[model samples]
Target: MVVRQTVLVCVLAVLAYVGLWALFSGDETETPAAPDAMFLTDYSKATTGSCVKFNGPGENDLGLTVVDCKGSRAALKIGTVLPNTSGECPRGDYKVLRDTRHNAALCLLPNAEPGDCFEIDTEDIQRSVVSKFDCAAPRVNVQVVDVAKESCPEEAELGVPYEDLTLCLRRVR
Candidate 1:
């Protein structure tokens, strides 16, 4: 009777071990999932056509600022939402380039108009660009659109004195 009892206990232990192993083990083909990516600002606060100032173009860590288009450091007016604010805004002349890294969205003035294909190199377009200028003057010419298609023009020996670049399209001479 003792021998039978011992044998029964051993079998039960082995079965229990096997059951636990099966329950804990995952499929060999399964892989751990990666965490979701995070952005700096909660863009949900913004609306379409609202004027906004995005701090950083890359990684968007600095966050966003809603500014007056007239007096503030307004970069772009929110247009048809690719990624931008969602609020009332003045009718914009052209769309500003989307800088995902900065989380920036600024538009040119209604009076100012973009010219040829403009290739924006910097993220701080508000600081880098001017209001409007003649295209012949050598500043970068731009045609703001909902989506950016054209590439930045190749730079030749030609270099301007280089001051504030026009955020609004500067018409060429």
Candidate 2:
């Protein structure tokens, strides 16, 4: 009887071990997934005519990502790349981004299209950002009439020179 009991115990131990091993073992063909690639743009190295996408909030936020110039995510275009010694962007509606750490600055212009409406900041144009709005919205005060116009028409309230063309803006409110 003792011999039979000892043999039964040994077989049970072997079965338990095999069952546990089978439960823990996963598919051998599966492999650990690779980490996602992180892409960071060095705004200081950005060149004139390159397109960028805003990455953070507020006008002072310099976080930007370089993207395709013709892509849908392109929000602003680099009009001029300046050194920190330049002080500020050229006079006009251009937005200024200063990178003191890299001693670089960028003059940016909104990638706006004709017929697009916007709500501009009348108090501080430099602090204003480009956010397109529906033409019928009550908050929309400015409208883009022509993007590549040489000169704005008499009806246009503001004209922003970008590259070789002029952005003819009219008061919509």
Per-candidate RMSD, Å: 15.3, 7.9
Query: What does candidate 1 score in Cα RMSD to the true structure?
Result: 15.3
> lDDT per prediction?
0.42, 0.72
All candidates' TM-scores?
Answer: 0.29, 0.62
1-173 per-residue lDDT for model 2 (tens digits): 99999999999999999999998988688786743321334556777877776776644554777776556556577888786736666655678877777778888887677877777764455678665567898878889888864778777777877656787888887
Residues 67-132, model 1: lDDT tens digits? 555533353445534345333323323434454553544443322223333334333443443333
- Clash count (model 2, backbone only): 0
- The number of clashing residue pairs in each candidate reads 24, 0
Q: Give the TM-score of candidate 2.
A: 0.62
Which stretches of model 1 miss by more than 4 angstroms? 1-40, 56-62, 82-173
lDDT of 2 at 20: 97
Which segments of candidate 2 are over 4 A away from where they belong?
1-41, 69-73, 85-91, 134-138
